[model samples]
Structures are given as C-alpha cells and as structure tokens.
Target: MAKELEGKVAVVTGAASGIGLASTGALLAAGARVVLVDRDDAALAAICSERGDAAIPLVIDLLDPKACATLAPRVLEMAGQIDILHANAGSYVGGDLVDADTAAIDRMLNLNVNVVMKNVHDVLPHMIGRQTGDIIVTSSLAAHFPTPWEPVYASSKWAINCFVQTVRRQVFKHGIRVGSVSPGPVISALLADWPEEKLREAKESGSLIEASEVAEVMMFMLTRQRGMTIRDVVMMPTNFDL
Candidate 1:
C-alpha cells in the first residue's frame, strides 16, 4: 500500500529528541524523506543510521541567526526540494517572570520565536514558487491561556500562534498551508524546569502527555486536505485542568 506522503520531503528541526524525534518517525512512516536538523550530531547520526536513507541528518545550532537563515537553502541543497517543514526546535523558560534570568529569557525567545520565524521566512520563496507546502509549528497550550507559572514560555507560544495565523493568510493564495500544534505539559526535556514534585504530581494526575501524542496531532495537521487548514490544535491530557 502506498503511504500518504510518498515521495515528499520534510525538514524537522530539533529532530534528535522529544517531539521532533517523534514527528520525524511519523513522517518517515508516512513515506516522506526527512532531513533531521539538530545541534546534537551523535543523536542525529544514530537516527539516520537506524532509519536509513530516508533520514538525512543536518547539524546546525539554530541559536545562531546566520545559520538559521540558511536552513531552507541547505535543506533544498540536500533534499532537492522541501515539501514540508516542522519548525519544532524550541527551549523553555518557566517560573515567575521576575525571577527568570535575562540571558535565559533571551535564549529561549530566540529559539522559540525568532528561529521559527526565520526558518519559515527562508522556506517561503521555495514553497511559493512550487505553489505547495505544509508548514507546522510546535506551539504550546500556554499560548491559548495565561499560564502564570511559565509566563515567558507561554508568551513565546502566544507569539507563534499569531505568527502562524497571519502567515497562513498571507500564503494561502500560494498553495502553502501553515498551522501550529499546541500541546500542554508534554513529557520531554522541556519539563526539566519543573520542580520534581510538580512533575510527579502532573504525572500522577494524568496531566502529562507523551511527545508522540503531539506528533500524532502534527500528522493530522500535515495530512489535511488542501482546501482546509487546521490553523491550531490545542491538545492536552484529558485530566489536565486549565
């Protein structure tokens, strides 16, 4: 049986771990050749080795704006063309805003917000020329609600939500689909900032969800019919409150 994404190419950032890794797996299973981009060279190599030719690894730190701006061209060089882009690279800054380190805030915003924007911007010309593409960003449930504990992280996602919607409108005429997936309290490295007790409490309460679940939602967004755009998907554990 033929898969839905056969012959298409996808570029996934932060592909060595967490949601990016899970999403890469999903895209590969659906028959898309995936370019795995991450700073972790060893992990990327391991994934490529396991997944074979379909997994192309690219090591680049998105924190450097210059490197980020070059991503689409590099992927095009490696893959010939990009049919999909999952801008999933991001960092987390939790806790009260006043207690957050200014430097840490800067880094998180750069990765979560700036990198996403730059990557999509770089890929637009290509997708526009082709008149077809799918761009899905990994946002957070916090983007839709005011989460007091992680104001900085939530704020970054809120910005992404707006960006995705605005960019979707601008590019729909070109046959490019843009959207975001917002998952709450996903089980990933981003949770490292949470207090041990809070993490345990969420887990015990069934308030945490796996990264694979979020990837599932991403696949749904990517696989939608061209006529309809799933602009945003907010997924959370059924037991999660607010």
Candidate 2:
C-alpha cells in the first residue's frame, strides 16, 4: 500500500536534534521526502548520513532573518515544491525576566518569534498557489498558561499561538492547515537550562515527555482527513502538575 505521505515534500527547521529531529523522522517514516534545515552543520550531516537521500540537509542560521527570505526558494530549487513546513526551530531562556540578560532575551525572541513569522510568510505563497499545505509549529504549554519561571519564553510562545490561529483563518480557504503543538516539559535541550531541581523532579516523576512523543502528535495533525484541521494539541506527561 502506498504511504499516506508518499510523494509529499516537507521542510523541517532545527532538524538536527530533539523534537525537530524526531519530527523529521516521523515525516520520513510516513513517506514524505524531507528537507532538514539547521544551524548545526555537523549534526545535520550526521542525521543525513543515517537517513540517506531521503533527508536533505540545509545548514543555515535561522536567527538571520535574511535566511528566511531565501529558504523557500532554496528548498524549491532543491525539491521543486514544498508540501509541509514544520517551523520548529527555537531557543529557550529559563529565568525571571528581571534576571534575564538583555541580549540573551533578544536572541531568544529573534529565533522563537521573528523566525517563525518569516518562515511562515516565506512558505505561504507556495501553499497558496498550490492550494494545499500543512504548517505545524512546535509551540509550548507556556503559551497557554503564565509561567513565572520563564516569563520571556512563555510570552514568545503566546505570540506564536496567536499567529497560528490568525494565520489558520487567513489561509483555510486556500487548502492550507496551520496549527501548533504545545508540549509541556519535553526532554530536549530546551530543558537543559531549566532549574535543575525542577528538571530532576520532572524526570524522577515521569513528568517529562520524550521528543518522539511530541513528534507523533505532529504526524497526527498532518494525517487527518482533508478539511479537518487539528487546530492545536496541548500535550503533557500524565504526572505533570501543570
């Protein structure tokens, strides 16, 4: 039997590790040709080596907003057309805003917020013209609830949540699906900066989810029947308190 995503082309950012890497695997497993974009050239090459020609690696810094402008065209040149875009690249700063370094905050926002908007903008025209595409963002539970521990991180996610919803409306008529998956405390590098005590506690209590679990949710969003968009998925470990 032909795979559901056979012949589809997907672009996944931050594709070298964690949720991004997991999502890339899921997309490939479902039979989509994948273009892996990341700033880590070595890691990108490593993943491509494992996946072979099915995974095309593009190493570029998403923090450079200019890269977003060139990304779609680059992908088109390499793959001809884009059918799915997983704008999952992001950075996290875990701390009270008062304690956060000004430059660090700017860097986080640049990657988390600005890059997301520009990536979506760059990919939209292709999907709109073809009248079909799926865009899934790796959002966070922090977006839905106020997070005292990381105010800046939470606010960035909230901005993306709103953008996904608004953009979903803007392109629904054109056969595009726009949504976000907000997972709580996933065991990824993003959690590396978490208060060590909190991180340890979550791990001990099984309150932290694996990156692959979130990837499964992303695939679920894309595999739905046409016209039925899985708007948002808020996932967390069963033992998680918040």
RMSD per prediction, one decimal?
Answer: 1.0, 1.1
Residue 79 local lDDT, model 2: 94
Query: Model 1 — TM-score against the truth?
Result: 0.98
Per-residue lDDT tens digits of candidate 2, residues 1-242?
A: 14779999999999999999999999899999999999999999989999979899997888876766789999999999999999999999988778899999999999999999999999999999999999999999999999999999999999999999999999999999999999998888898888889988888999998999999999889999989999999999889856
The whole-model C-alpha lDDT of candidate 2 against the native structure comes to 0.93
Runs in model 1 deviating more than 4 A are none
Candidate 1 local distance difference test against the native? 0.93
